[model samples]
Target chain A: MPDDAAGRPPVPGSDEAFRALADPTRRRILDLLADHGSLTVADLVAQFPGLVASGISKHLMALRAAGLVTAVRRGRHQVYAIDADGLGRALAPWAARYEAYWAEALTRLRAASTGTAGTDPRE
Target chain B: MPDDAAGRPPVPGSDEAFRALADPTRRRILDLLADHGSLTVADLVAQFPGLVASGISKHLMALRAAGLVTAVRRGRHQVYAIDADGLGRALAPWAARYEAYWAEALTRLRAASTGTAGTDPRE
Candidate 1:
């Protein structure tokens, strides 16, 4: 139910996001994009000696398809950057469930330490 | 460099976590476990009419391997529950990078919205 920066409906679900993040090489591409703000395919290829331009492009395509990164054509080069909101939309809800569980756990820990196990956690 | 509940070194990296989460059926199994607190293979199979106990067991094994879920032997059945800390350890660092980006983005947004784009974002 999330929307893109252009107000368009979201591209893919968490499954695609998870799939896109499954590869170490693809993750390295994301880290590069995060550090550089934006980079061209040539720039990315230069960073990984064993990787070719086509291989980098394919990874970028998967990232783009998952809405995890955005590519904009500036002149002859397509520069890519992390789509923070898109990534959040794909991951936040899933992460929140676990976070809530952790919060409750911490509350229980605090209560146990204080010898207030019978009292309300909020109190 | 996360430690498990037993204080052992983490079993897998974010790559395995992402791969394990990429499947819809596996995700559904996680959702069921989250809501129910814990479930056995037979219990999980009952939830999905088309899925067999073996299929659910396979999914549980993948989940366990990813450090996303924990299994405890209670009598003859293996009861599975969400391993929130293990899940967080596998995912937090990767998620934190994007979170930092989002935080900076919000700062920029606040600056732009207030017509004070020239000033330092932190200020």
Candidate 2:
């Protein structure tokens, strides 16, 4: 039922990636990983006092499933890190489509911020 | 309870935007709007024969709330178009954080495809 039947390859893992990113907690987790480079569930749980180990574990599972993160067994702890390559592979094509739009939007934003649209600098 | 209390301004509407993008049907709707520039509910419904107008309407509503689309009343129809500026504002910060990671990943990807990583050709 997907429109990809018209000869274009579907963006594999993109749906799972989007769904995984839908949670604020998960996005926060990515932020932590990006900041720390890698972390264990305990490390993450410590970062979010309001959340429990189980909850963080569940979020990590979703992130892993989405190919947004990778887990490696390190001694007694499982280390988790952002899977940058996997993330790019999963969402780049879809995200790239919006680059031109984003660029134009940013130009308009800068114009609004500086209050200097269509004004001659020499004037 | 959000982690933004420590002096960082939260990315507004990002949670809703991520949630809106989680659905394939909704993503397809964005693609349609991007391609066509604008469309009415009936126009969108006609694009997907299996989905009814109400279903597409709900998707549009979610997209609107996420600031991903804008609906305008023209004559007897409500027209929808991709709200590029809004979309940039909502997701740019969050997405920008991953730019470095994405760039490195792309470099690795190119190296992989061309099988020329660290191969000095001046030998």
Candidate 3:
């Protein structure tokens, strides 16, 4: 069963959005979508070797549920596209917070590595 | 069974690290650890309302497998702490790439929104 079945409401802040991104296959899908505007399921599946089409379809469903991608019917086939700025809007804030945290941590690490704790040479 | 059972080798670049972070509960756990140092499972469980202890234990295990936290046995109780600079080392690179991508996209969006597509008024 999907973890989203645990009655977690589909809020923008929900984990489902992030969880949908944790898979490498899905990340690759996003990269492909970013590079190429839209692709059919058959074309997307061809990007991954040794994986069955059914598995790719399931992964696509997860991405769709997370609002990361949209599937549209183009005649007899469905085409997938990265939802207009979907990840940029959803993940940017989350990543920005962590980026600030890590930036400070990295600066501290560099200072510690150089034995410059509490000493500002520019002073 | 865990999704990591797919025989994908545990490389730092593997999807497991990102997958481990896709959980909101785990993100909350990280936030708690950042605010307060080491905490035992019992202490951590108190932070969440209505969640069973065993479930929290499993969540911690998932975080541990992702190398996000370190658990040490203190007598009968096990205390977990955020691994020093773990996430900073792991997620910084990934998030940096995406940040650059979004920054450029945002710049473009702002330009497009302002109707400044190919005209350099500064000239």
Candidate 4:
């Protein structure tokens, strides 16, 4: 669980985080924010020619709820930026475990595919 | 794209993989298969107290589509097992990138949180 400004429980990094990340569009938004630091909704929407403003807003909301992005009031526009720290932390453990598993599996797969015995090409 | 048994294009490792993994029930199913090697549908369903057979079947379908598990006909019963190699490969790259990002962010965060300068405790 995350804490709010007042240290209260904040709904962040729940299954919603992965669900929000499941979308290609939202993933693109994060990529954009990562590359450009921050952008207004209009600016972010401009990057996707096929997406409507409302649709992008909905995506933004999902990202925000997942703590992947932070929306700030910049004058009249709500600017969004990648909350890199939060997003990175949220994904770390999941990635580390899977990476290790895959690395081992890939090694085994290579050895099996090559028909090599005893050598253990995976090592 | 993955290849079919006949070397045709098989749908595997698509967004469907992540979507299938989104369900906690399905994840638990994978975990069970990993632990038990293989089990019949009835056996797998018995592990879950409240879930219905149909629901578990649906989950099994999703997991199969995602290449997370494989089903084999053992007489009348359909036995399920974790497709460890496929599932492991599918999650590897995604996990690697996110883990690297998180590791860097954690380093920065620790420095900030401890109010230490120059030392770069993250290393």
DockQ of each: 0.15, 0.28, 0.20, 0.18
Residue B52 lDDT (model 4): 65
Q: Across residues A1-123, which tens digit of lDDT does each residue of candidate 4 receive?
A: 132122212223535677887766676687678778899999987887676799889999999988889999989999999887778767653443334456666555555757553422222
> Candidate 1's residue-wise lDDT over A38-86, tens digit each?
9999998887676668878998999999989998999999989989877
**Residue-wise lDDT of candidate 3 within B30-119, one digit each (tens)?**
767866779999998887765769988999998888777899999999999987566666665455435654565445544564754432
lDDT of 3 at A97: 35
Q: Which tens-of-lDDT digit does each residue in B57-96 have in candidate 4?
A: 9999999988888999989999998786777666643443
How many times do residue backbones clash in model 4?
1
Superposition error at B46 for model 1 (Å): 1.5
Question: What lDDT does candidate 3 reach at residue B93?
Answer: 41
Q: What stretches of model 2 exceed 4 Å from their correct place? A: A1-9, A104-123, B1-9, B104-123
Each prediction's whole-model lDDT (CA): 0.70, 0.77, 0.69, 0.67
By TM-score, rank the candidates, best first. Answer: 2, 1, 4, 3
Tens digit of lDDT per residue, candidate 1, span B94-113?
A: 55455554444454445564
| Candidate number with the higher TM-score (1 or 3) | 1
Root-mean-square deviation (CA) per prediction: 12.3, 8.3, 10.6, 10.7
Q: What's the distance in Å from true for residue B85, model 3?
A: 2.6
Residue A52 lDDT (model 2): 73
**Predicted model with the maximum lDDT:** 2
TM-score of chain A of each: 0.70, 0.76, 0.68, 0.69
Superposed model 1: Cα runs more than 4 Å off: A1-12, A101-123, B1-12, B100-123
